[model samples]
Target: MSETEQNGEVTAQLVDGSTPATPEALFEKLDALDIPHRTVEHPPLYTVEESRSLRGELPGGHTKNLFLRNKKGGMWLVTCLEDRAIDLKDLGERLGGYRLSFGRPERLMQYLGVIPGAVTPFSVLNDHQDAVQMVLDSALLNHDPLNFHPLDNARTTAISPKNLLKFLEAVGHYPQVISLD
Candidate 1:
């Protein structure tokens, strides 16, 4: 938090002081792995439209994360470009998650440890039980720096696609990369 380093990741607590999934903890993990990242704080964003409005032209692959559960209670965290259209039925067939449905808020917190608007692969940090599978869109990997909420919607973090995979593997949640057509 210096003059020249404005807009950098500060490793701070979430507004609610939530445990096991705070931005502070995520930042610490990123730092420990020597994964270089840049983060900027802005007005809390709950939608793609709001992100574009407030985050104006941030260079990178802007992402939207989905928390889905299959009929068998299996869960997945899907990260794709904000503009990517997802057909849940097709996705379920492809991922072998037939009859997929959005996880309830309570289940979302139970698994990924984040609220609806705050869902992101980074929340897998709190997936201590490794109960959720991570699915990454192949198109997202083409972008040099991919952007995601750092366990909260008020801030966004940027990292290289390679580093993202590295961080995920380090955390024991290696993602299944697929093209979501």
Candidate 2:
């Protein structure tokens, strides 16, 4: 592992001068994992409110993914339902007092290979080093088909909660589930 990896730089090179996985490449990986997913291409959505416009056309539970880091430079990707309320301070307390803050856009791209609007658990596909910790809300499991951007905000992909976990494990990002109750 590189020093960057030790410091939680997930977007580092993939072995030897290789590039991060593209959205299409990520889809292929999911396919290889035998993870069933349905995707819809539409206008780019940068916020939950923007995604609301497609509620009628896009069915299933949508998600909001956060790329965060702690004072110690530990990285975390938290995914929960789009409408779920989040109290960062409280969450930080629950997660071992991380002093959490949103990761910088450059680091996000470098690690997850995605911009602010495109952050998703799928971005882990780019983190070949497993440098980022994954945090998932248990409530999201109640939804049969969970929706997320496939490393791009221009499209949304739906997959079963079980399959999501399976895919994450396959990619070496086993989630740490939390209940928001």
Candidate 3:
């Protein structure tokens, strides 16, 4: 089946006139965890620079999320400041043992149930196998309210730093806060 025939239509139907499982379910989980957050919607654009441009429209700190994979196909989630210049190689080395690369779209969909241009920590909610591990840039964790996608490109979610830690804990993953610099 083509991408459009599969999730595209379903996602469009769910997102066009209504919110879908990706973001809605994530929010439900957040609510269950008693984690408070605000959602912001934007045009579907796939770059950190574009996402950063929406910062003026919001009152939250912006973050960039990377869905990466080790050479062994182990998935990793890296959430950091939107402005930081992150070299994947340097990051892989610092993170230790295994060259990092962009994860395959198939693996992304299979593991996180998220498509390209919509990677986020919220996607981790779909990772029932606990295959994806999370890493938070220390600088970003220091910020008060950080914004990220709620598993969709059309919306952004802002949550307190404490709430973020809480959400991660709720998702059953203990994120490692590291200094990206």
Candidate no. 2 TM-score: 0.88
What are the lDDT scores of the predictions, listed in order? Answer: 0.85, 0.85, 0.77
Instruction: Report the Cα lDDT for candidate 1.
Output: 0.85
- The all-Cα superposition gives candidate 3 an RMSD in Å to the true structure of 4.7
lDDT: worst 10-residue window of model 2: 1-10
Expressed as tens digits, the lDDT of each residue in 86-150 for candidate 1 is 99999999997487899887777766667788989898887777889999999998997999999
Please give the range of 10 consecutive residues that has the lowest summed lDDT in model 1: 10-19
For 101-160, candidate 2 gives per-residue lDDT tens digits of: 889887787678788899999988888777899999999999989999998899999999
Report the number of the highest-lDDT candidate: 1
Q: In candidate 3, where is summed lDDT lowest over 10 consecutive residues? A: 11-20
lDDT of model 3, residue 119: 81
Which regions of candidate 3 deviate over 4 angstroms? 1-21
Off by over 4 Å in 2: 1-17
lDDT of 3 by residue, 119-173 (tens): 8877777777688899999998677778878888888888898888888887788
Better of 2 and 3 by TM-score: 2
Q: What TM-score would candidate 3 get against the native?
A: 0.85
TM-score of each: 0.88, 0.88, 0.85
* Clash totals, every prediction: 0, 2, 0
